[model samples]
Target: MIISLSPRATLLETIPFPAVTVCNMNGAKKSVAEDIDQNQSNDSDSLFEKHMLRKLCRDNELMSGSKVNASWSKMQNFMVKVSQPCHTMLVACLWRSEEMPCHAMFNPEITDEGMCCSFNKVKRNFIYRNPRQLHGLNYTFPYPSIDWTPESGYPPDAPANANPWRVFGPGKGLGLTIVLDAELFDYYCSSTASVGFKVLLHSPVETPRVSEFAYFITPGDEARVEITPKISTTTPDLVNIPESKRRCVFTSERNLRFYRTYTQRNCELECQSNFTLQECKCVPFYLPKDSSTRICGTADDECVENVKDITEKRLPEDYKNRTGWEKPRNINCSCLPSCVQIFYTKQMSTGKLEDMFNVQKSFLGGKNLSYYKQNMAVVHFFFVENYFTSFEKGEIFGFTDFLSSTGGLLGLFLGFSFMSAAEIAYFVTIKVLFSKLRKNQRKENITQTRIFKSLPFAE
Candidate 1:
């Protein structure tokens, strides 16, 4: 035992430690090291998560679908189809009701004297009741207004000063379908000895789509208005997309003068109203009429006729040397449709009805059909399949745009990042203020020491 022991051996022999306990202690140390490694990995993962969240937020700000850029080159495609019955049927029967008084019948007692009576006579009876004596019948029903609904009845809830017979249907179906009944047509023919009807086939789209139609009939006799639908497809050079999404940048304000919002229909309507005002000294009741301006009435028929004549007869040569504001030699009011084009091809047939039958048992009964024997025509109108087609234009910025913008900003301002911005804020709000406060305190202390020295007193 007297053998020389090294310092390590002597230290181990002095401690009352077992080998198994030392092994267990070493295992505990390994476990602690493993926990430290896991913590480091978790910290790296958290940093990665933070970076991803920041990138996502930035991407959402730039690529959110709320805003769009204006561009002229952008384009969108639309396919519209309208399905309708091949043989369209329009039953021209009198819409009659007791509520609607007959102004055509004259009082026998009042007219017996053979004296001149006032033109504005009292309507004492209903027109349908005295069908035999329907000479002075006025078949001109008032046009329906924009808000007019058939559910509200014949006389709509309208303003007193508003025009009557301003009949306007809401809107047509995108792909419209219509069915024709031969039995209904036959019933209309037998129900009235004579009737008046006009069949019009036009695009369901509002104004600026196309004002003209193929089939037009004047009030009188039983007739058939047939349309062999033809399509005139137009792919406009320019297109309109939603303003909320994108808009045209190159178009001038003067070019879009008619519409404040720049829609084809609005522009056309505005142009028409302006033309009417210039020619007739009044706007049509159907068009927008200012309160100061009078609406065109029956009295203004002559002016309307004159305007129509001027529009139809003037030649292009006559327009030479005239200013743009000056009325064109031809009363040409050109309002081009936007990108959408709708064309209707029409054909017609006509015939006469010999006898009359009871219309109360027909489909036209509940609709309040009024009869006028002088005008008789069963007009049918409908659209064919694939009736409408539209094209739109729009613009957008993609992820590449966002990356390019970000890179540009970064290149333009080197060393500028969120950390740099935070540092700047800290400098301005905390570091600068602390420096100023220390400087002021130093100055104040110096001043106090000088005052003490100047007083020549020590406490």
Candidate 2:
């Protein structure tokens, strides 16, 4: 009799098996089948080799299919959990608003002081004797002539240039330009107080960027400048957590009116200045000073403390209502943090240098001996991350992503596509709705027939 066998059955039957034998060595019996199984098990130790063996064995009972399938399943899971990587670039700068104190000295010949130049001699004495008193004062060399127009032209915006730098003995050394007076440079070198400057950062990309400048200095002689950068990030949703949570993301003005890139520190300083002006009708010497307002001196320490307490809301309830004391509007000064994280650190060093140069010839035709000494401070900025820009790897998956992955797997292994998904939806929704409608129609027809049959007269 002839018999037909299925493909799986044929495959199983075709799988080869080694012959078994019994042998004795040193009074110990060993089976040849056991030796063959041991060699096969050793060959199957590697996952790839095991998988190949299982495929080769087909439906053979000698291979465990579950183990090979599980290995591939684990690999697929690992690939699905991987994250994507990206990179970015950035640019930034530093700036300040408060004006530096400077003085211009006249040539002895022009002032007609002979051996003793009034402008140079007196100003030098005043600077060395009482530097604090010279904070907002402007001194012209030999005074300005009737026809003399201010060499430093007005800045385009006045509010930004409200407290313009005092350029001493200058030719167009005003506004943001450095003072050209040698004497003023000497004074800056000798001054014990640290100076402050504004820093601004600019970038072409749409990503948000911010920076902050911090330094250690004497507490009472602290520099007035405050550096704060805006917060920005590509992953806003992740960094900007709700009030109940937090994330790692952190979140400039022009010449006079700094560009909007000004940092939070800038806003706070400006707000404090405004508050001081409103309370004491003056600002501290370190802050911007105008003709309408005098600089706050040591004598105004009490008033300054009062204003600080009120503005910062540190005063008691009774003192809160003190006349002319109003809380500063911090809301208007609100600043946001950048989504991207940025940290900037600075190191500074100081040194002294000596040089000799010929001073301008005086009317006396004799050159006076002048000593040039300079004390300089250098600052270096570096990124803590050791890179100008950085990248973060993240994974964002949702229910839609899961469904898409499932559909992709189906298409890869079972030939399923969008059309197949649409057909399934149609069967579950449209077909089911139609079937329900037909069932209701049949029940209504049955009731109608029964009602008609019961109406004997109308039959």
| Steric collisions counted per model | 27, 39
Residue-level lDDT of model 1, residues 9-119, one tens digit each, is 111111111000000001112222233324444453333322222222233442332222211111000000010111122222221111122122111111101111111
Off by over 4 Å in 2: 1-261, 275-282, 288-303, 306-332, 337-344, 347-428, 457-459
Best by TM-score: 2
For candidate 2, give the lDDT of residue 32. 20
Tell me the tens digit of each residue's lDDT in model 2 across 376-437. 11122211111122333132554566788889999999999999989999999999999999
What are the runs in model 1 whose C-alpha is more than 4 Å off? 1-195, 205-269, 276-281, 296-334, 351-360, 363-376, 383-459
Please give the lDDT score at residue 37 for candidate 1. Answer: 29
Model 2: per-residue Cα lDDT at residue 43: 38
**lDDT, model 2:** 0.31
Cα TM-score of candidate 1 = 0.30
